[model samples]
Target: MTVSITDVARAAGVSTSTVSRALRGRPGVSDEVRAQIATVAAQLGYTASRSASSLASGRTFTIGVIAPYIGRWFFGTVLDAAEKVFSAAGYDVLLYNLGTPETRKRFFTRLPVRKRVDAVLSLLIPDEEEAAALRSLEVPLASTVGGAREGFTVVGIDDHAGAASAVRHLVNLGHRRIGMISGASEPLHWTTPLARRRAYLDVLADAGIEHDPKLEADGGYTVEGGEQAMTELLAASRPPTAVFAQSDEMAMGALRALRRHRLRVPDDVSVVGFDDHELAEVIGLTTVAQPVTGQGAEAARLLLEQLDAPDAEPPGHVQMPIRLILRETTAPPSPRGPQ
Candidate 1:
């Protein structure tokens, strides 16, 4: 027979109401009685019902966390950080990895998150129709994808400025023939990749360097993709003297490709990347550092704020700063490179 909250209360010689308050960590139960109830519950192997708790408090005590992908470093790190925050606040997290079209369709159509989670946090920006559907749920929503979304509480870094700084660093090192390792294109409403890509183009244009269509290769935001893209760049008629990879993972792959081709970094090609990933310093990669963990944590906190007080005003936005970290990977190009 499964032990229940009633068994715990009976064993502790307390009312069911007292047991509920004590086990749930709610107020009104004294420290001494709470300890006895806890001890009894453990000994009896009793567990409280989430449904009962929800009925009493009118809250699911759960937060829905949605992301485009989970295996990637950025997504995993953010989700882990957010989960920590939610766990500490007595809330469970329901993860949704809508990486494929089919999964996304199922999510929106089936509404798995409907009436299940008290609030939602999106790690990737949704399209207008999807956003409208989310809003229809009438729950507090937050995101850490793009900067300052209108209807959602947002926490993100300025992608355009961060990418610009990375490209400008290469330019300052006297590199005109700069190749770009870009990420795959995103959905129409997701502007993070576009913002970063636009920054690269804008910075080059500002420096009076004519755009070379062949200089940019899509990295697909993966190591293998980055290596392949780098190989393509190396085969260009006039290879770049320096390269800027949109992500550290891509930059790492670029480094590998250059090594395979027997080209010395900084001497043959200076390189820069975004996202100061954990292994970046280990490999001495120069990158633009954004607070990935902090961004997720803040997004969770913002959702918590709304959950705590339904009528409370939303926290408009939290735009975290980024830092350009200079490392051994970046330097002035060799004299043999294109002018």
Candidate 2:
């Protein structure tokens, strides 16, 4: 037989009311007590009765998390952070993986999450129509690592500034022929790829360097795409002296391509990446660092704020800062190069 809520409450030495409060993630329960309850309940194989709770409170006591892709490291980090936050708050999480427009349309048009979750947390999906459709839902909406259409709570980094910082660092190192591997094709609407590319172009123009179409490559925000774009950029008869890959994964791939071409990083060519992923430090890659985990937690907290008080202040945008990590991958152009 399935474990009963009363059994869980008895195991945790709490009353049925306390168990309900802890399980519903209702306010007034201490974090420690809630954790204890959750542990005991799990040990007893106790699952919350969503139907019963819905009948009583009209809430599923669940939060819906949507992301464009779960395969990316950054997106995965955000999802994990959000899950932890919601779990701590006594709420179950429902994940929706809508990577393409068709899937997103079907999800919203179908309203599959109806009566399933209390609020929806979208991670950097910025399609205007999708945002509109989601807003049509009666539930609360929150976003992390990107913005929404209008009247939504969003937490994300300042992509334009972050990109400018990365490119500026390269320019400060006297790199004039810096090429970019941009992420223009990522499904996420508010991703920083195109902004970074724009920053690169703007900085290059500001530095009085002629923008060369031959040097830039569309990397599509993946390691393999970066590797392929890097290969193409390196194959030019007059290759760029430096490159600013938009992602650390891409930078790693660029490093591989450079090694394949018998070129020494920072000696023959300077490179920069974004995100400061773990591998970036291991491989001594220069990149822009954004607080991804913090963004996730903050977005969850904001959603909780709305949940706690429905008639509270309206949601607004929150932009996180970025820092440049100068590692061994970036340096002045080689003396033998085009001077």
Candidate 3:
């Protein structure tokens, strides 16, 4: 026979209402009584039905996680870390993948999450329309890898600082003619690409180097895109002595492109990338490392805090740190290169 709440209540010598409050971790139950009730429930193998619990508490105990692309290493890592936290807290995760503009439009128009989840964690920076739609849902929301908005909490690394750090590393290595491989300029709502590109320009200006638009190419933040962009940069009349890719994946592609052209890393061309991906160590990619997984966990925690106390003060922004990791991919510019 399946054990029920009544059995737990009888065993703990407490009323059903008291047992319910204790199990839900709500107030109005003494500590001793709550402990006794919990012990009795566990011993009796009693498990509350989630459906019933939701009906009573008006909480689904589910979190909706939205990401632009789940296949990407950063997004996958964040989702995995966030899942662990929510699962341990007796909450389920519902994933929504918005990989294309069409899918994003459908998701926002449908607004399928209504009454299905207690909170939301968005991995992408929403545009104005997307932001308005999210607010229409009236659910507690938080974001990772995005900028802070008026009503939503955000957890992310300093994109501008990360980009500046990459450029600084190249400049310090005596590289005057530097190039950049960045994400495509489309999807203007995504702030990371814009922030990083702006920082790269500012850093170059600060180093007394005139910015050359010809030395920059959009790599689309992919290995293939990086390869194509690197090819274009190398074809320039006066190519850069070093290149900074916005992502390690792009950097890896840049490495491939250089090899194809019979160029040696740190010899013919020094390279740097952002986000210390797992393969960075194996390939010796110099990059700016950020806490990708930790950001996800933090986003989950913030959402849960809001769920626990719906009337609490508005959530604030959280900015994580990033550091440059020295590796073999970067060195002083070769003397033979153009000064």
| lDDT against true structure, model 3 | 0.90
**Per-candidate local distance difference test:** 0.89, 0.84, 0.90
Residues 1-339 of candidate 2 have per-residue lDDT tens digits of 988888998889989889998877677889999999989998888987867877877777799888888889888988988889988876888998888878877887887887778899987565777777778777788887554448678888778788889888888888878889887877756556767788888898888888889898878778898999999998887888899888888888899999999999989999999998878889999999988888889889888888877888856888877899889998899989853
* Top TM-score hit: 3
- Per-residue lDDT of model 3, residues 55-124, tens digit only: 9989999999888889887889999999999997889999999988998889999989988988999988
Off by over 4 Å in 1: 1-49, 186-188
Q: What is the TM-score of each predicted model, taking all chains together? A: 0.87, 0.86, 0.93
How many Å off is the CA of 177 in candidate 2? 0.4
Candidate 2 Cα outliers beyond 4 Å, as residue runs: 1-52, 188-191
- Model 1 residue 6 distance off true place after TM-score fit, in angstroms: 12
**After superposition, candidate 3 runs with Cα above 4 Å error:** 13-40, 186-188
Ranking by lDDT: 3, 1, 2
Compose the digit string of candidate 1's lDDT tens values, residues 1-339. 999777787889999999988887677999999999989988888867878889998899999988888899999999999999999877999999898888987898878899989999998888777888898888999998876766799898899999999999989889999999987664436777788889999999999999998999999878888899999999999999999898999999999999999999878998898999999999999999999999889989889878767787898788998999999999998887786
Quality of model 1 by C-alpha lDDT: 0.89
Give the lowest summed-lDDT range of ten residues in model 1.
184-193
